[model samples]
Target: MSNDNCTSNVSQSIIGVLDVIAPQIAKANGLLFWGVILVGVVVGIGTYAPRYRRHPLIGILFVAATTHFLPIISSVAASVTSTELLIHTILINDGLNSRVYCTQYAHIFLIFVWAGLVMMVAVNASVIVVGDARERRNIGPLKAVTGAVVWTTYLTISTLVDLYREKVATIQFIEQRTVANVTVLGQLFLIMYTKLIFKYYAFYKAKHSFAHGRSPSLVDGYMDQLQQLGDNSDTPTILKQGEYTEYDARLHPPALIVMGEDNAQVDNQPYGNRLKWIPGQGDKVLTLDRVWKLDDMDMLQSPSAQPKYLVFSFTLFKLLRCRFAKYTISSASFTKTQKFFRYTLIKGSGAAGERAFRIVVDELSFLHDYYNSSKPIYYSHHGFVIFNIILSLYTIGYCIYLMVIYIVLMAMGYHHSQIYCSDECLGEIFEADFAGKYSDYVQRPPSPVPCDTHADLIDGSKCTSYTILTWHIATTVFEVQQNQQQHDKCPHNVAATHLSRYCAYLVACYPELLTDNNDEWCKRLYEDAKKEAARVLSTPRGATATYPLIVDLLSTQSTHSVLKDGASLGKQLVDSGMGWEPLARFWSEMILYVAPSENLEAQAEAVARGGELITLIWAMLSHAGIDRK
Candidate 1:
């Protein structure tokens, strides 16, 4: 055949083939691209739509910035390859610069770009999926093995595809040389960024949790012990510290009440300035009900005070040991308030083993105000919700548009085309692609570095592997030590106001527990529990049920008597040479002054109960010391 005729026929054939595939390819690419974006939309909505609108906007911006990278390439390719002459017919007949040649090249480049984007996004999504799966499944070694196998399969497939594309397609830039050269560099940078962000978030959460007292789990391991004592115990003696219930409403007449005090402040006014520490302030003393003698003018001048332990008996006393209620009151004619508390005490074995305690707090009158039908004068949280919904809808629409454009570009041969020069190019692309994934990789929180390196490395298998210590681990260790020293009052610097108070309180309360003696005792007890198949509290973050055992002394009649006996045993405990004496002081610091509750009557009751418990613990300690002698 003549060369001209051969070229002409080939040109026609190429044009015919290109025309058939271009439209279908474009459609498929468009669908796939949009599908991913739609997935992102679902993710954004499902994860963040319920949040404020500002969050949605920011999330959309982030996903749009990150996910649209691949689609953008497709858009650029589509625009460049629009000319009709860029079809295969021109390539065969007119040569490389013709419209067909240019179209073919553009189509090839576009394919690689789109493929890179798809793979990267798919991998990232897979990472999130894998994380969620691991979290939900909470699987062990077997699943981990399975996951490893799957990972290996993916890597093998990726490597093989990368190699194949390099050999087959001339546009092997992404999978080969481009990926390899830049992956490690990208991974290193990403890791640093993640570390900083994680640290900042962790610090914020820890501080927040401390400020707004974290909730203590009701079902701690101590629950079973406490319940056992509560169930089998003797009937408790109920006690009243002051007037159990007497209300004289004539003290502050209804007509004399100030309007400001009577009117509830519900205007949604901001409570405190930024610099003011409002949340941690002590409770205000509000006068609720009082009685004034009509004849004695001196009674009005003197302060009519309630008992100090009044609040503790009402609430916290219930959680500690059982209590004994002892009632005795003065017959004085001066002004007085009514208070009540319930106590249950369990008698321990022997004269010295008796234990008693309380968990209640002091009571106070709580005034409940009726909601008035005045027009509301506050900003609604609903407005932010509405804004978020609108923002999410806009994001979804924008994402859909990008998907369609990407699909068209992919159809025109801009992705997965057989084009690129060398093996080096293929290597670069694969590494770059793999490294791109490192951006989303979150490293597990760094564990404490093992001081006993030999023991850690030489397990039952006796394998020796040196573990690398992370900077985070090192920093956390230092911070923990600093916290410890602060608690110890070594520097005597009250630099941390609220934190310092708590640290001092903890130190004063658990001085023994913080020392080597308590550590040794706890270690033995914990180890024994492990060996005995007993349920012991494990200090795992997020899963830690409750703190370790807290001793209660209120229940036992033996405890009550010992407390009664402690009046004598106190001198004996002080006389004993054993170091156990200091514990009495420590115990005093720890168990005293539980947080005041908002219940007035309940608070007074708890305080009374708590006092009974305190008396009981003291007796038990005294008896214990005497027995040791």
Candidate 2:
């Protein structure tokens, strides 16, 4: 009894002591987070600038970006949502520090640090917040900007308070420590700054910055590798008469294993073919103006003229070398490699043969979030891969939360205030057709190919999904019939085919987004349509489902099956000889009709997967205050 009582007493005392010091413990926020950030920084440096040019680390960065989210949440909870965790403990006081008081060192040091941090926050935040033309998979601009504002504001406030403390040292710590809470933004800033700093140390400093004096052997050996690549490519000393152009648009870099060079050739959009310079302030934001580039000959003629694309040596051996032995690299010197790499990547032209290599590297870096460095997941470790996938999902959820906050804030802003924008900007963004209602399209049908060919689209009262599927089938039938007549793949042909297929895809794949409050019904409707489509469209044993047979059956049959209705429409379109341009216009209208959705759950899922076309259109419609009745 005595021994048990003693143990119990001691345990109670320890608990009592820990409880008393809880406030002080909470104040160790900066110290504790800094330790984690430092470790992350070190790990990140090794991950990106590995001793050799073996593989890419950009994918891993995206995967790892999700890591600090939980910690951020926990930190916020601990500090009562104050990100700075301004010490409320009465025992501790910042004003009492003798060394920090009104000294020359404090004032000068504060000025330098404050100026540097402010400049960096402005520049870095802009780069992060403004959408990059080259990077499609980054955290969207809204989230980036919001995060920047939140973090910078907190940090700025803290810095100002500290500066004031340095100058006017009398009992100000009481006022500073009395600050209640800074909110979730402070925690978010820590994660963002940690990521940004790590990126700076690993990618920018390792590849571009020349502050770190590079080794002699590293420089010499890297040049030799370049020489070997040049030799293997077989270059002429002088340009041929026809080969020379007034201004070459691109610069090709050396296609290294780390840049997905081993598998670049297999893709239609080759991994090594896309490159953009590190966007300076001069680089204009790539507008959403051209969603899908219309079929232009410039797209075709450009790739054919470049022979250096052949120089990329993609092999299974090289891929495996990058995958399994990324850390193990050739001992090469790179003293002047940073300058050469910069000029070769950022300044040179495609005729210079540096473009391909630059593309592979730049794409991997800029589009780190969207692409995996390796074939599947970049890292060989399955544990981290799975963990990252979970974190990514969490990050997506958080982004969606931010989006909701954005919408709420927007609504609040516009409740009593007028939205001010130029008429040109409004015209560009909020087109009437993008609301995509069937009623709206029917009211303004394109001429010459009268609404008779696709009368099903005239009824806005029908289930949106049913109309989409039926019309898409009809459009496909007509497209197949007209395939043998066209010489060139025109924009109309491309647009009609793409939109028709994509809308049908939404019907088959994303039915939940088509209906209001009847999710179960939407899903069941899809299954029924799918079954009907299979029954009606199925071909005979070892035979093709020809357009004529499909049209005849569809036009003749009178059933609830949407495919039959579609075939009937296809027959009308065929008889009318509907031009590709008009057919394309119909599809454009149909796509818009289907894009207006209210299913927030499906939308959230779609947004998490980098957003589908329908999702984008739906968001636009929501912004425009258009809704299905």
Candidate 3:
């Protein structure tokens, strides 16, 4: 009887204490619940706003912080309401027992919050995928959708399980279970959120470092090593002081430097003009102090060995670790975890390694563009073209096949006339130049044949019937003359000259890539031109020569002379009153049409070795939609 009385007294004392504490706990929880809601709304707006979205790290942190807070708030509210019910049973109902209420309200509230979070995740994922696609990034839509769906399903399942546990469990069991589960989940949330925070912090550091004009620590170190390597290398430069490198300079004789000519203009010339000799530029010529050699091309092409630690990879690995190993003791494995933590905190985030990688990539891209723009003369690698071929195989193959068909048709006596100029005088010149041995190369098809005609010219027969090669040379010579006559620079002439010379280079070096007949004709023309040049040089009058003098000597040569074809062609063009501007435009258009579009691999290979004129033409043709597959 005394033991029972002591137990009753102890129980009554516990009830009295609970009665005092329960109301205070409810009041505090009510404040906390409203506080969490207020904080969540503010954080949501702050995170999702456009201004905050730009700083992804801040946005991620806000989301993670809110997520962690919500679970704790729910747990507290459950405890508060349960204690209130117990107090009502003991005090208001006048019962000797206190009953714990099921945490159904808290479970429902959590489910709703998680549902909203799932939707937010889906929306964010969609936005990211669409945004990346709009920017031409290779983000697979299906992969993004799958990832979103899986994450959403997982969250939904967890929420549903919490709700089920509240419904089926006893009040005492539910209270104990909810507290333990919430505690574990909150800890897991913190670990996961902390990992994400660090990952984004790395990204933040990388981007900020770059924006501030400082190389990321990782990139700076790598660059230092690269500079050291370059300094230690024994590679020779292409051009020393006082040496001039001309455009297509390898094929031609060293330029004759005329005395007493103004040389000041040469030094201020642009990059393109630096490779060619100005017609009137005197003894002081354009020279390179230092130039990239063919060996440099190899070095440029070689990939850098710098470590690339992306924030995305870090985040992904952390997430996987949390998902698979969160409950396992192995998640805290000593050596590997310590190493990873040290590496990420020190080597990875120390200087924004990902940003450094991106910087390297961007610099490499700029170097590529520069290399392409300058047009390299030689290539050291044979397989360089393979990359281009693989990228545009069908387009390249179709272009090659079309070229072959056109060549075959031309060889079989089918001819196409020039479309722009329908001048009768030009026709007469073409007829006279190709009249004898080259008659087969220039044949006039019957009436109603396709030909380019001026709007004002009613007669199609007035269009010239010269081969494409003849038109190329005539326009090139005319453009060169016009460029010399004008003091101001003509961009069209510059383009025409470079393209024409590149075409000539192709004919001389890679004849098999062109039509067989045209290749032979170009070879014959080059040989004849060399002989005529030698003959003209032998004459005392030709000792001091200009391009015009050379043209005159070639034009006046007899029909039986080796340069008779070029002579007649040059004379006819000179006699025509049409200025060089129209001719320059004609050659520019003609080269675009005539340049071999086949084998982008070959062109890319050329570009990798240096820049390639063929690659430029190919790119232009693509832009103009002239060579669609």
Q: Once superposed on the true structure, which residue ranges of model 3 sit more than 4 Å away at CA?
A: 1-489, 492-496, 512-525, 545-552, 556-562, 619-625
| Top of the candidates by lDDT | 2
**Candidate 1, which ten residues in sequence have the lowest lDDT sum?**
366-375
Q: List model 2 lDDT by residue over 92-207, tens digit each.
A: 13332111111111122222232223222332332211111222212222232234335445544665466456433232322343232123334334444543553333332222
Candidate 1, residues 291-362, lDDT tens digits: the string is 111323333443333222222232222212111111111112111111111111223344212212321112
**Poorly placed runs, candidate 1 (over 4 Å):** 1-10, 50-166, 170-629
Tell how far residue 172 is off in model 3, in angstroms. Answer: 82
The candidate 2 region of ten consecutive residues with least summed lDDT is 429-438
lDDT of 3 by residue, 144-219 (tens): 2233334434553465465555453334434455564454344333333332333233323322221111112212
lDDT of each: 0.27, 0.39, 0.35
Error of 2 at 121 (Å): 30
All candidates' TM-scores? Answer: 0.22, 0.30, 0.25
Task: For each candidate in turn, give its C-alpha RMSD to the true structure in angstroms.
Answer: 24.0, 24.9, 33.5
